[model samples]
Target: MDFHHVSVLLQESVEALNIKPDGIYADGTLGGGGHSYRICERLGNNGKLIGIDQDSNAIAAAAQRLKEYESKVIFVNDNFANIKSILDKVEMNAIDGAIMDLGVSSHQLDEGQRGFSYQHDAPLDMRMDRRNTLTAKSIVNEYSEEEIRKIIFEYGEEKWAKRIANFIVQHRQTAPIETTGELVEIIKRAVPAGARRDGPHPAKRTFQAIRIAVNDELGILETAIRDFVDVLKVGGRLAIITFHSLEDRIVKQTYNSLSSGCECPPQFPICICNKKPIVKLVNRKPRLPSEQELEENPRARSSKLRVLEKL
Candidate 1:
């Protein structure tokens, strides 16, 4: 399958960066170079763009897609969580701006063999980085029922997680759960028919939860925010587009933590911690895609763009 991903919140995210013609920038998620390409377009020959992705497929596609500006583009096959080291290797102490769009690409979901979609009847493998040993197969067949339940409930926000976990455990005991189809069947059985009839595909939440757990999507997020803040030059912007509530929450909290100054209690008259706000939230609220953008790309509906500028 071609590594294709429609960049969500395209214009909003790039504009939030406030691009400088000669400035250095980073696309931490670099999905098909959508945002990076636009950033490059606004840059002069002196500008630089660092693109990073854990998936080799994404790396190759982005490299090819943005080859026109190869002179200013640097690609890396690595997780965005390691942005600090990525920037370090390039000898970059600071960047003018950065962007992170935390959404699974369309290609990943469309490719049945990748096993990211519940609709696809493929092996239970949802490793964003194929090099990783852990997969959805092991999470389904090996993890304890309680653990699975926790993941689904916490990560997926699925109310039927307990029942789904129970069903998976029972079925796997007879035979190891080996495929996405098998898992979907179990989820369907676990959820009540009436409830399943109401909203979404019966297996969507479980699949999302399993994929997130397999990849540790929520892990390293807060640290990444701090790292981005550290590398951003004063007035440099950090724009993030998150697809789901969990990702949005983390970004919001991290931005607030970094932008909020003074750790001292309200009653205290004198300053103690000596903390100062490092960044300012560009907007009090996240920016949503325009109605036209959502109409053009339905996948963009859930996207919310949040920006922060270094103090």
Candidate 2:
């Protein structure tokens, strides 16, 4: 399958980076090199851009799309959570800016074999990097009812998590939940007929929850955000685009905490905690897609872009 992904918030994210002619930048989730391509356009020959993605397919496709700028680009096939180590290996200490688009690419969802979409009846495999051992099948078949319930509720924010988890556990006991279709049917049975009549697909949230758990999406994001910021030069910017509320909340809270000048209470007579603000929020509220972009691509609706500048 062709690795294709419409970069979410394309123009906005690139502009937010405020690229300089000779500055160094990183695209932490270099899917199809959409944003990275634009960043390259704004760079002079001396400028450098590092692209990283866990999926080998993304690296290959991005290499093709960004071939013209090969002289100024470096591609790494690794998780963004290892940004610090990757940067060190490349002999770089700090970067002028970095951008992370935290959405499963269109290729992942469209490619039925990946099993990221509920509409597809493929094997229960949702590993972003095929190298990973744990998959959606393991998550569904091995996880306890309570564990599954918490994943659905906390990650997917599905109100019917308990019922859904219980249903999955009960059905998997008879036979392993081997495919997306089987899981979708279990989800349908879990949701009430009335509730199932409207809204998104019954299996959407459950599938998302399982995929997140299989890939450790949230855990990596939390760690990557801090590490990304830590490598930013003074006045360097970090822009992140999250597709889900849970991901957005983590980004927002992390940025806020880092931007906070001090942790001491207002009543404190003297400074106890010597923590100083590392970055300032570039935008008080996350930048959302415009009505025009939404019309062009419905998937862009959930995207929230948050930026911070290093102090």
Candidate 3:
């Protein structure tokens, strides 16, 4: 399938990066090259862009989309968690800015074979990187009920996690849960009818939780945020767009920690715990999509963009 993803907060994110004509930048989530293409447009010949994504399909789509700027673009087929190593291999000491959009691209959800969305029926596979051994199927068929419940509750924040996990455990005993359709049916049965009648689809949370567990999405974020900041040069900006509260909370807390000047206890007037601020918030709060953008692309509705600059 042709990889297609509508970039969320396109203009806002690029402008936040504050692209310099001859500065280096990185698009850590490089889905469909939407953000990367915009960065490339703002760059001079001396400027370069390192676009990285774990999805091979994303990389391929980005490469083709950015073919016009091939000379200035370098693509990497690895997770952005290793931003330091990625930059090191290219002999880049530091970058002027970076952008990370934490939402799964539309293509991933739309392509049924990838099995990211509960809307479609396919194999229970949600590995962002096809190379990974652990998949949604493995987690569904293999994990203990307690373990499954924990992931759904903690990761998905689904109030019906207990019932859902119990249902999954019960179903798998009869036969291995092998497809998204089968899993969706189980989720429908687990969530109460009144609850299922309202809000988003009943299967949304469970699928999200399973996908997160399979890919370790939340697990790698905090450290990656700090690491990305470490390699940023003075005045460098890191703009992250998160689709849900979980990642937004992580980014908010991490950025606040780095930007906070002191960690001294309230009573300590002696000025101990002399932690200095490393970065400043580019925006006091996260940026949301405009009314027009939301109408044009409903998927952009939940996205929250947070930008921080190295001091």
| Cα lDDT computed for each candidate against the true fold | 0.91, 0.93, 0.93
**lDDT digits (tens) for residues 97-128 of candidate 2:** 99999968988899898899998899999998
What's the C-alpha lDDT at position 151 in model 1? 97
Cα lDDT of model 3 by residue, 148-235, tens digit? 9999999899999999999999999999999999999999999999998899999888888888899899999999999999999999
| lDDT winner, 1 or 2 | 2
lDDT of 1 by residue, 157-222 (tens): 999999999999999889999989988889999999999999889898888888889999998789
Separately for all candidates shown, the number of backbone clashes (residues 3 or more apart, or on different chains) is 0, 0, 0
Best by TM-score: 3
Global lDDT of model 2? 0.93
TM-score of model 1 vs. true structure = 0.98
Candidate 2, residue 126: how far the Cα is off, in Å: 0.4
lDDT of 3 at 19: 91
